[model samples]
Target: MDMIVWAGAVLSLAGVAGLVWCILYVMRLRRKALDDATMRSRMQKAVLVNFAALAVSTLGLMMVVIGIFLS
Candidate 1:
C-alpha cells in the first residue's frame, strides 16, 4: 500500500513537471520568430505531448485517491 502511494506520488509529480515543461516550451515558441510551417509542426508535437502528460497526471491522481481510500 505504501509502495502504491509512493508510485502514484511520483507519477503525479512527473506529470506536473511535464506540464511545466510544456508551458515553458510554449513561451519559448511565442518568443521565437519561426515560420508558419515550423511553428505549426512544433506546436502540433507539443500539443500531443501535453495531452499525454495531462492524461498521466489525471490517472496518477485517481490512483492516489483510490489507494488512499482502499488503505
Candidate 2:
C-alpha cells in the first residue's frame, strides 16, 4: 500500500510536469506569430497532450485513494 501511494505520487508529479510543458509550449507558440492555420494545428496537438495529462493526474489520484483505503 505504501508503495502504491509512492508510485501514485510519482505519476501525479509526471502529469503536472507534462501540464507545465504544455503551457510553456503554447506560450512559445504564441510568441512565434505563426499563421492561423498553423497555430490552430499546433494548438490541437497541445489540447490532446493537455487532456492526456489531466487523465494521468486523475488516475494517480484514484490510485492514491485506493492505496489509502486498502491500508
Candidate 3:
C-alpha cells in the first residue's frame, strides 16, 4: 500500500511537470507571433498533451485514494 502511494505521488509529479511544460510551450508560441495556421497547429498538439497530463493526474489521485483505503 505504501508503495502504491509512493508510486502515485511520483506519477502525480510527472503529470504536473508535463502540465507546466505545456504552459511554457504555449507561452513561447504566443511570444513568437506565429501565423494563424501555425499557431493552430501548435496549439492542437499542446491540447493533446494537456489532456494526457490531466488523465495521468487523475489516475494517480485515484491510486492514492485506493491505496489509503486498502491500507
Candidate 4:
C-alpha cells in the first residue's frame, strides 16, 4: 500500500478508461457512413490512442511491481 502502488493503480485505471473509449469510438466509427479515406484517417488516430493507452497500462503495472519489490 505504498504511494507508488496507488499512483500505479490510478495510471492503470486511466489507461483502461482510454481503452474503453477507443472501443466505443470504434463502434461509433463503424456505424458512421463516412468514405474510406475518412474512416481510415479516424482509424489511424484511434490506433495511436489505443497504443498510448496500452503503453500507459503496461507502465503502470510495471511501476506497481517495482514498487512492491522496493517496498
Best-fitting candidate, scored by TM-score: 3
Q: What clash pairs does model 3 have?
A: none
* Candidate 4 whole-model C-alpha lDDT, 0 to 1: 0.94
Instruction: Report the lDDT tens digits of candidate 4 across residue range 1-71.
Output: 59989899889998999899999999999998999999999999999999999999988998899889999
Candidates arranged by TM-score, highest first:
3, 2, 4, 1
List lDDT for all candidates, in order.
Answer: 0.89, 0.92, 0.92, 0.94
Model 1 alpha-carbon miss at residue 63, Å: 1.2
To one decimal, what is the Cα RMSD in angstroms of model 2 from the true structure? 0.6
Pitting candidate 2 against candidate 4, the one with the higher TM-score is 2
Off by over 4 Å in 2: none
Q: Could you tell me how far off, in angstroms, the CA of residue 50 lies in candidate 2 after the best superposition? A: 0.3
User: Which pairs, if any, clash in model 2?
Assistant: none
Best by lDDT: 4
* lDDT, model 1, position 62: 82
List all candidate RMSDs to the true structure: 0.8, 0.6, 0.6, 1.0
Candidate 1, 1-71: lDDT as tens digits: 76777788888988988899999999999899999999999999889889988988888888898889889
TM-score of each: 0.93, 0.96, 0.96, 0.95
Show model 4 residue runs off by greater than 4 Å. none
Q: What are the runs in model 1 whose C-alpha is more than 4 Å off? A: none
| Model 4, residue 36: C-alpha shift (Å) | 0.3
